[model samples]
Target: MNYSHTTLTGDEGPQQQVTMFLTRHTKTTANAIDLIQGWSDFPLTQEGIEIARQFGRGLQGTRFAAAYCGTLTRHYETARIALDNSGNDNVEIRFEPGLREYNFGSFEGRDVSTTHQAVAEWLGYSTVEEARAARGPKFDLDVQDALYALDAENMLHTDLVPQDRAESADMVKQRMWQAMTNIGDLVSREGGGNVLVISSGTAIRQFLWTIDSEVDLTYLGNTAVTKVDYDKGTFSIEQPVGSMAYYERGAQ
Candidate 1:
């Protein structure tokens, strides 16, 4: 559980800096099922392998000091396969507990919709009826409303939930902050080189929030990669790193 770190590559000097390519793990069974996967270690689906291959194509020419991933099999396997396809044997893979997905306690490995429904019912509300009404054509209720309703319903179960099991959004943020700080310290102390981070979507979004609070984390597309520049103690968000527009198509 010692997930703290300092550097990934190069020597420490005045010219040293770190540029990170933040990426999420490719499609997985959890994703395909629309489940709440917090802390669950599910293997990737076949489609996930294909999606990860695409990500590897983006890293072909990009030099990395070292790469980091969570301890979960989905993340580690994706990193391994992607690096193999990229033919980048030089980049190291580091495993850290702080990089693991959010811990959701009893909610792990369960359908998100079912959990939402159960929580709503626990709160003494007829969620199915409400959902039906909300689903009416031209209702114009945004998806955010459903998310809020689900969150509120879950909150009502707070007393039934136990600590060391369920993780709140705030807790997830704090853990990610610690992990990134450790990575930053590494870059600050070790010098200049690219570092690729393979983490869960929410963890990556939390990093984005720390870098640019204005960016919408929930708005990112699936398996997206965002580039960030960190130099002289300042961080700036850049474009997605895996766009095909940047590189010619390689062998499929």
Candidate 2:
């Protein structure tokens, strides 16, 4: 239950099995500023740099069989810093584009607070949730309200990030599942070993979604790692790494 030990090097070996250590990227300046960063490439803040170093140091002795990261600088830099600090400079870090974040089209780099206000005003709703609620039962929606929701959803996700592109949680889930399948293949081909994957909070939430369909992305611990073990067609979750909750497949 002591998941916050700050050391993972002890969980490595040539043990005829594959183990994945999934970590979220460190904090960013955009995060500190309450911006809807989405796929926008933001450089790491000074604290983010230090956090990466500390994370790497914590895993110093765990020699990874392979490492994976996304194309984003946030993910790449976090992995590089962690790997470099952990003396894993020799590990071939594989970059996979499929692991990128959900594109937050029109909202990229915009202040979430202001964006919410604008959305609320545009939809004739006092709040963003009111807008969403109106889109469902109990509240009547007008033609413009529907269009605003469509635009807002687009602004939440997309690669080119159109002026009015929004992404549903389900959309993110699909891509993340695809990435997992990709990682599973990579592990299977490598004959099983330890892996260190560096990705963003959104992608990480998708991974959590892969296991728990009811998981809320907003509630996931950003800096926490999630350890997953897969073998013999079975998957077991080891809670949120650094947290006291260690969950296995269903009830005992």
Candidate 3:
């Protein structure tokens, strides 16, 4: 993909576009075991490291003006590996806490299946499968909503610390937007170019939802790239959301 955008500058000086290559972190041990990673820290699995390298190899010629990732092991490692393989290791990656995954609070590190079942019950569904059938693409968002509600009501895992309650969807959306806009504005001021960002699956999905509610929220595979363009104080999602084309290219 060319990964560039052009828009009229109008009275705001020269037109500058910052293309963001927003990617999800590679697979982690938690992911392999069907655990809810949330804010819980976990290192990337061997497969994940190779996937990140492949992602980098796919972008052999692309030069990044700026690089960033959440202040988490998985996020940082994926970004580091990708940049190194892509020949952009010289770029310093800035850590952004706002880019962190949605804090699952008490639910962090729990089994994914159990978590979904609890969320389903909270949502009035008899089972997770029933919820999935009814909610379709919105199932994931509903799960987040359930988590927020449960946390707010002090209903999740009584043994877990109260402070560990899940973050509301709105909160995640706000922080993500702030972080992304900050990065975009900063890059635009510095004469616009390609920007690389590594964030978690749920965080990326929620952020994209804030930009375009109709976006497919089904799934975001590890190391998948979602391209976005920031131009004229607005953000737009480019075609081929959650793309694996780059990874496929590199794997070949």
Model 2 agreement with the true structure over 141-167: per-residue lDDT tens digits: 132233346566564454543443645
- Backbone N/Cα/C clashes per model: 2, 8, 1
* Candidate 3 lDDT score at position 137: 69
**Candidate 1 lDDT tens digits, 1-252:** 234343445545564567777677877888898888767888899988877776677568777777778888887877777777676766678876677777766566778777667644544557845754654321111222333345445643544334535655566667776776667556666666787777887666666666666664444334566777776657778865333331223333
Candidate 2, lDDT over the whole model: 0.62
Local distance difference test, each candidate? 0.64, 0.62, 0.86
Q: Point out where model 3 deviates above 4 Å.
A: 1-15, 157-163
What TM-score quantifies how close candidate 2 is to the native fold? 0.70
**Ten consecutive residues with minimal summed lDDT in candidate 3?**
1-10
Error of 2 at 79 (Å): 0.3
- Highest TM-score against the true fold, candidate: 3
Which 10-residue span in candidate 2 carries the lowest summed lDDT?
243-252
Better by lDDT, candidate 3 or 2: 3
Ranking by TM-score: 3, 1, 2
How well does candidate 1 match the true structure, expressed as C-alpha RMSD?
5.9
Between candidates 1 and 2, the TM-score winner? 1
- Identify the runs in model 1 with alpha carbons over 4 angstroms from their true place: 1-15, 116-161, 219-222, 240-252
User: What is residue 103's positional error in candidate 3, in angstroms?
Assistant: 0.3
Please state the error at residue 16 of candidate 3 in Å.
Answer: 2.0
